[model samples]
Target: MNNRTGCEDPYLNYVISRRPFGWNFTDPPVFLPFDFEKVDPFYWVSLMETNWKVAFYAAAVYIFVIFGLQNYMKSRPPFELRKLLFIWNLSLGIFSVIGFVRYVPGFLFVLNQPNGFYKSICVKDGMDVPTGFWTLLFAFSKFWELGDTILIVLRKRRLVLIQYYHHVVTMIVVWIVGPLVEPIARWYTVLNFFVHSLMYPYFSLRAIGIRVPVFIANLITFLQLSQMIIGFTVNMTSLYHQQIGNDCVRYPISIQAFSLVYGSFIFLFGKLFYDSVIKSGRRRTEKKLL
Candidate 1:
């Protein structure tokens, strides 16, 4: 029960290996005993790895399109595409739910395996999970998610700097990590999918004129800020592990990049939560007292 790497199982074979510079990586057993190849093929994965530039170019175009469309819509009445919005948000919610269900367990199972949390986060692996197929899917999903911004523009909602910043930075991070098969960073993807599973559905219900509880809206923002805080902590731990020469396989430079991004996210999400929830709620209370 070994592959080319001579480990005991396919999981260990792909993840645990000797790297240059005297570093080593080891992984736990697969939660489900099946051949990774047996998993369904994702067609666009190869193209993503081979023609990485396409992601960059597409990201550039996304920025241009966001600005252009927003400007074009400025003079016109906002189209309340209620039905379309409902469908779009619901579909994305379902997609995020599926991603969360499929991938989070796989990663959590990895964490539960030997070597503890730090090793699980720091150890780099090859495309262990079917060309890193699900991970790649999550990365590509970011592109598909640009539709969220477009919808906002069409609706004449103000595009906050953090919104576009998150989209662009996320695409770049995923593009870099997806090809590298950086399993550690996929934690970000898992958390995002979980959040979106709830967030998108809430948006869909609102679009359809359903009354969602105000607390639900505040909870979503809190969860987003919490995600950033936890993520930043994990990256910091990874950085610390790498610094001590734990023999864990990691891309040092990439870890640095991720840490910086997570730091930024913490500030942005915190600010957003404060403005939209705390300050707004306080203002409402003041008005009620008056």
Candidate 2:
């Protein structure tokens, strides 16, 4: 599994062993047709690490597009893109579910190894297989997810500061840090995939005029709020580990960005849940007493 040098199998670089189901098999799961390192586009992982201006420019464009669409739709009636919206959200929901299934197993497998979670994140290895490929796809998907703002703008829905804040900051941070497969990132990605797997499909059903219980909707918001709180805690722990030189590897910038971003989500989503669910529930209870 690992050598005395504190490294893992050179070819299966992140695993102690894929025993049980994969006991006889020698290789890790392969999702891509070719090795990710051999792929040309993956070179951007290192390139973007150095050329961060590209990420900034992409963020700028996303911001401009969202605001531009909102302004353009000011005088226009809200487009009834309900069918299209259902399709969009459904697609995202399906994608999130698939990501959950594919990545979570590999993620847990790595974690199950002896000190594997730390080693997987802290070290870079050529043989880490499909996890790298999925991470790239997940990062790339953020660019397209900017369309979520566009949809809101077209539908003439009120875009709060939280909405813009969540979208823009996520795009920037995810793009910049996506290549860094720090162990904390596994938690972030899995949380997102799990949340979206439920949230998006719920919204998609609503888009199609299918009414679900209000509690289901409330649960989604609650899950989001919980994720921010938990994620913040985990991130802080990671930073502490890094500070003590506990073999944790992460970009200083990534940790800093997450601090601000996750911190905002905690407050914003907390307020939203209180306003939309908790307060409203209290009002209904008071009215019933009358």
Candidate 3:
């Protein structure tokens, strides 16, 4: 790491140098039983590494349950679990917001260093800090998010290919790559938290019968597409660095896998945006003329 003072900011300097692996908050306001400062992130890392197979098991169960439930619900009235949906989306939105807050500062701090952009994408740091704690939670949350498919199935909503594929692939990838603690993993975590913060809250509003503006819905899809584009770009850049023998850009296989996924997302989300926004708008216009 470069020897510059961390912008005269004590917190930033502490985050950069100390890289402490525990919560920064104290008990007076946010009271918890254990010592927040004493928590070890590596313990969680080891735990995740050992239990990575659980993601596959969960995915298998998830596939079986979603299809089975869809079949079972075919002859029944759709359940309107509006309250539960509201709660689920709201909880995830709040979690994502907190994650985004925790992650962005460290990410920005690293990005401002010398060759910061490259280092941010290449150097694996911050895995032993509070950020890592959130990253682990984010990975684990994928299993919880599989419940989304259940909601769709129960509601008799059409679960598109991208929906389940995205969930299962993401669950597997995050579980496998999360333990590696690659620098690029921060990029994935931060971008995902940022997107989900907006996404789940939007779902919350709709779940409770709020009529959100059409443009806002379109904007969310656009943002999702943009996120995929950025992710693809990041992976490709990392691959380029690795090709040129940049020692910091570790984990070539992981990068390639991520690149493939994001590349596919660009197509899937783009088609969704065009079909829902552009094509729908044209149809509405033609109807008005008719």
Candidate 4:
């Protein structure tokens, strides 16, 4: 082994991350933070093996909280909340970019081919790289995203079914799937970078009071669904191919959990898309006929 990295451990934040950011991913293993004492030792891992149970529990909790809050907000007049929501979403968006930008160059230049040789040759090339930073960033971003709920709550916005469910399930999913780790983490990050590159700007536009065209909204949803479809297929294939198990890296069980969530979300959200927009048009047409 090389004598030393001549630098501190890349995961110093794991043990000592402070707030506004957090100590979330500084964890027992992988790139996640160590000893997130709020949950049990295997809380993250249990989310994978018992996903449906956990997912439903999460969904139920959010539904109750969101709807309860919505009813409470009904008594109050609408407060001007755009600025706060905008800043919150924008901050998360920027954090996503920071995490994405930090990793892309290395993924492209070093791991372009993405077979066994890429890992080997990339390491030997003496790149000024941190081995596990992407995983760390991806892991860290989940904690940052908890702010999504804060905005909805503080701004007294109506927490719709989809938004509430998305927030809660994603919080649980990232905890379970460990989306930022080795093997699968690379592809997940790349795909997320691509997705968020589009997703965030859409938020930014709407935040600034620009109306996103209906077609644009539909296209964005389609792209998101497509991302999940591709991710599930590719990850399953990678899971199978890597069964040869020559240490080319692997996703751990958490990736599989995320794949299942992606599959479920695509199905649920696809239906949601049809129900919300297509049915709205159908209902309008039927009313016109009557």
Candidate 5:
């Protein structure tokens, strides 16, 4: 299929033809690193296809560094790099907002058309467009987000298992599935971008000593849990399509892996909400009554 024009699939052609207001569908914006008009987006696709295994290597190194830093910090004073953490979260938050803008219009445009729902789940065209460029960056950004853990460790904060596990699994899964260019990836990318746009900025505010309300934090966790639930639903839809002999372009193994990861997230986040919010509220209420 021609990734540039998406001429082979009529639906994809339709999607590419209509440029929504404020959306960059063809070329990378000036702010982005590469000039997509000069460089084929497939060049990066080829790199991802070939070097996907490198995510595993990077994850291994990340694990080593985080654990080693944790042990080293046990005997020393924690360095409070408040300014740096603020910058980091703000940067990622901005990037996520950009990604959300780049990805969502096309997704909504596709979903509103006839048979659009199925096509959104199965069609894989327009890889040389702006969506493709941002998708590549989205995958790579997983690695950059690992820095959040490093910041936590340096601050002598308690690093929970869910935190690092989520980072590592997310990095690995995005790397492995990105080159496949599955249609379902649109949902994953869009929802994640939307969540992070709120999440990272909230963290940035806290980093700078801003007193955000408790409810806002709860809302963030709620959005994250919703994202996970939707992710599991998308994977299940893929599996159902495959079972019915539809032409969904996802591997069975990848679908299974995604299901497991998302399912685990549902449980982990639910526990977190219960422990931090519900139980804590009950405790405060009981103390008030006493």
Candidate 6:
């Protein structure tokens, strides 16, 4: 009955402990804000914690909508499957590489002085530690990701359970952690930018018409797998070092949920990719030889 079995459910623990500071959730003439100082960080993350129900409907709704539209449109030019598919895969591929690449400079920024982010980028600073415009831009990117699912639906593409779940959940989780974990967010962002850079380009290419070199897709998957692996490794290492009374970066929650969510996603998708790519390729070669 417990969401946690140990004291080490990082995200659960950190999010539960978060208290609010003064910040606006949305701005403009109707600047809706929260008294960050008055609210508990726990409440904020809990409230925004990826709404799976909404996300589920969000994931499925589009598929059906497209199905109906396709049906009604009669001979609707067959959905232009080629170009759209290229863009989709191209985006995912480029995003992966770009995200990783972006992490490089930020890596140096911390290397010169260093905090735990050097090891893992999921660490957070207190609420006011704004690194400025670019940081906020990264924070807001979470919103843009909602459009990703839309792209899937519009193109009438198959939605893998893991892909659908991963995209939606990650978008929400990252947003939740973005503000909460600021210390090494730059590392995570740059890594993500690198990933996105590669990811988007891959998707674009897939959309336009090109079978992505299998290696590129494999590389993206490998990179993602590494991210999660590193995430888990760093969390436990930090946890261990902290236990030993050493001064480790104290952002456990980011890693906790990260390990849980991303770990599962990486494993699931990795297996999926391996099965579809490697195994299938092997089988095809074997069949040809026979």
| TM-score of each model, in listed order | 0.82, 0.82, 0.86, 0.63, 0.86, 0.62
Ranking by lDDT: 5, 3, 1, 2, 4, 6
lDDT of 5 by residue, 205-270 (tens): 999999999989988988988999999998998889889998877887689789988999999988
Runs with alpha carbons beyond 4 Å of true place in candidate 2: 2-44, 114-128
Model 4 per-residue lDDT tens digits across residues 200-278: 7678778779898877777777777777777677666666556765443445565567667778878877786677667
The numbered model that scores best in lDDT is 5
Where model 1 places Cα greater than 4 Å from the true spot, the runs are 1-46, 124-131, 288-290
Q: After superposing candidate 6 on the true structure, give the runs of residues whose Cα lies further than 4 Å from its correct spot.
A: 1-78, 81-103, 112-132, 249-252
Q: lDDT of all the models against the reference? A: 0.73, 0.72, 0.78, 0.55, 0.80, 0.52
Residue 39: error of model 2 in Å? 5.0
TM-score: the better of candidates 2 and 6: 2
- Candidate 3, after superposition: displacement of residue 174 in Å? 0.7
Candidate 2 has what TM-score? Answer: 0.82
lDDT of 1 at 108: 68
Candidate 4 lDDT at 225 equals 73
Whichever of 1 and 4 has more TM-score, that candidate is 1
C-alpha lDDT (0 to 100) for residue 117 of candidate 6? 48
Of candidate 4, the 10-residue stretch with the lowest lDDT total is 19-28
Model 5 compared with the native: what TM-score?
0.86
lDDT digits (tens) for residues 254-277 of candidate 6: 767666876687688678768877
